[model samples]
Target: MSRVFVKKASYDNLDQLIAEIFTLYDINLRGKRVLIKPNMLGAFPPEHGNCTDPRLVAAVVREVRKQTDRIWVGDNPMRVQAGGGVDDSARISGIYEASQGYYVNVGAKARVISIGSEIIAQMPVSEYFLEADAIINLPKAKTHMIAGITCCVKNMFGAVVGSAKAKIHYDAGHAKRFTQFLVDLYKYFKPTLNIVEALTIMEGDGPTHGKIREGGKIIAGTSGVEVDAVVASMMGFQLNRLKFLQLASQAGLGECDLGKIEVVGDFEPWPNFELPSTYSGRPMDNIQVAQAAEIHEVWGQVGRLHPRFIEENCTACGSCAEICPAGAIALDPYPVVDEAKCVSCFCCAEVCPEAALVMPKEEAQTLFLRLNPQIREG
Candidate 1:
């Protein structure tokens, strides 16, 4: 059975708590090239709850230092602009300082590898990630627009370098395919250890752009899939609703069934934890279908389905136009989408810092019912 350890912690006591966890998990890093991967999603500050807490990163780095001095801490954030890279993101999130002078710009160098997924045949991955003897995955406990919740398993997507992430979203075309791609990627490059920063988590709608809540917990395990299973339960998300977790479990990646796993210490599910606006906690046999219907392909027959831009929230930063793989968006003083050229990838929505670009969920249940004639609304 997979084992997960949960502890209620604070930044003041994190270093001691992490050292204890490392010992309990028996994570050995002596004389090894170790890469510490943290959730540096963008240039957002820690208080925003977008990236992993810098204090958590610092604690992990110190523990790793006890065994090995050869350590690198980094992640490839979504490229919102032309010149912005991992260094800018790391510094802004205070991860560079917290890394204790071990931060490396992972996006600077990459090596191409064969992914062999249905979405893409080959892709670029970070050289630092590939050269590591062991990878310590540090993911924030947060809601994601696409994956419902991005914890241990979804965090591995940072292994892909630069704009290739947007391209992968474009190739996958919708939520179901994209989720499958995530499972495939995780299986290929599974981390040696998984640790989640649940002390502060994002809700409402995230990975970015969500309200912060006090989770007051840290979860750790060797299996990313199993760790994510525990996180989903803590957030009050039905295991069936997260398709990627189900797929990962089916692929024999780890035991996703909570009953089958071993849980250690002070685990209590949060009461009334808010989920993403896109998810309604409805009952459905095909959860992937529900996700696709709500987020990506609303007007299936009509080809005009695209992201709705919130003009007031936009900064005219041109991030949407820059990240569009199809070049479908143009800045006419403000952004405008050319319906015919748009691929409905939602890459624009993902890269929008201000939450300006969003999927339409005004009448989600009605629209989903209309689009899927066979599947009845819950």
Candidate 2:
């Protein structure tokens, strides 16, 4: 059984928190190549809770550096422009300064190499990630509009660099199929540890577009799926509902069953947090398909779906491209989703920081019917 160490901590002092985390996980950073992958989803501020807190990451760096001088940190931001590249080295330096340590963008400095054969293009990645001896994944725990939740596994997607990421989503296009891609990625880059930041989790249309909840919790584990399974349980959701988690488990990557895992530290239930109505619109299910059809109809009308982009609000960041595992989106003049390619995953809409993208109520209703075809009966 994998061991997961969870602790209740406040932001006032992160040094003590970092020490407790390292001790519980039994991580020896001294003289080890430590690659810290932060959830820098975008160039958003810490207050927004859209990305991993730099302060938290800095604390991790300080502790790890004590064990070794070889500390590398970085992540592939959704849509990074030339000047504002994915590295965002400044933010990294700021955190290290606070902790009395320094860091660098490992991805930027390190060379990119191909992983496996490219389904669409040549020179696909996995090598740069594999080069690291020890990897520390820092993922922000948040509700996802699709795939249920974005925790450790989803964070690994950023390991794929450049336009190659966009190309993969174009190839896969379906949630189930895209999930297979995630499993493949996980198999390629298995991290030594996963540390989840649930101090402030997002809900509703999230992984990006959601209200923040003060979960005030941190979970660390050797098994990535083990950590996410616990996060899902805290949210009162089943592990089965999370497609990535299920895929990971099926691939023999990690365990999602809470009953089989050992959790240390504060193991009490979460403070009964609730997902916002916008995100929790379809909880009703029935044993019979015919009976379930009734629930689908109500949900269909309420949860319509057609991608809507508010031009004024859009930054054209192309996060939608990165999260679209199906590779449906292309960053043309603006973001465009090939309907034939879109699987209604809404990962694009979910990761939009400006709330620039939206799904129309009517279209969502139609999608709901298609997803639950039996409910289309008159």
Candidate 3:
């Protein structure tokens, strides 16, 4: 039976909780190559809940250091070929300081690994993941625009290096198929342990731009799927509608049923937690979205994941254009994107410094358009 351990904790009190996890479980990390993969969704600070808390990461490293000297913390940041690499995110998010010089640039080197799935057969994984004997995944408990909830299962997407991610997303254009791809990825590159950083969680539009909520909890488990199941349930997500969790459960990856999982500590669910808007209109019983053309053909002739530029927030950094896999974005007087060429991968948004690229839901955009009659008329 899979066990999910919930520890009531704040960033300051993480040591005790981490200690409990080690004491509770029979995990052996002594003298082994360990990779600490944190939820590094670009380069946002811990308080924003956009990425994994550096404090939590440092704490994990300290604990892991007690057992092994061969430990490295790394993540392949969502950037274009010319933009900042993992170190930039590490420096910005304070993860580099937390890593204490063991930080690695995941995109620096990679080894292609097979997902063993027909949808996405081969992918280049970060060398850290390939090299590690034991992986300790520290994912932030936050709602993602794409996968719904980016916990244990979704965090593994960082394994695929740089622009290759865009290709993978392009492959799984439909939301449901993309969710299944995540499950398959997790199942392929399964983490040894998962500890969720939920002290400050992202509530509204996230894995990046969102509102912060203080749920004040730390969740841990041996199986990534089981930990995510408990966390998703705690966040008041209906399992039937949550495609990632449902797919993971259906794949026999881990037990999503609350009855099957053993909760080790007190769990308080966030009833009013605001989920993202990607839940509706996805891969259904008959919807076939295998090609990019199908995406534009599906919803009002525009792709589901539309990358819109927030003019006020944009500083003309040209990072978006530089990083766009399709070269759909061009830096004119501002940034002009060729919608037809864009794959809706959200990489441009991921690398932006000013949080300028906001991918609002289609309905939300329509409502905004309605509010501004001039823009609507134009």
Model 1 weakest 10-residue run by lDDT: 280-289
lDDT values of the candidates? 0.81, 0.65, 0.74
Screening candidate 1 with a backbone cut-off below 3 angstroms (N, C-alpha, C), the clashing residue pairs are: none
TM-score of each candidate structure, all chains considered together:
0.91, 0.79, 0.86
Candidate 1, superposed: residue stretches over 4 Å from native: 80-83, 281-289, 292-305, 369-373, 376-378
Preferred candidate (TM-score higher): 1 or 2: 1
Candidates 1 and 3 compared: the better one by lDDT is: 1
The digit string of per-residue lDDT tens for model 2 on 315-371 reads: 777666666666667787578877665655555665576787775533443344454
Model 3 TM-score, 2 decimals: 0.86
Ranking by TM-score: 1, 3, 2
Ten residues in sequence with the least summed lDDT for candidate 3 = 283-292
2 or 3, greater by lDDT? 3
**Tens-digit lDDT string for candidate 1 (248-267):** 88889988789998999979
CA RMSD of each candidate after superposition:
3.1, 5.5, 6.4
lDDT score of model 3?
0.74
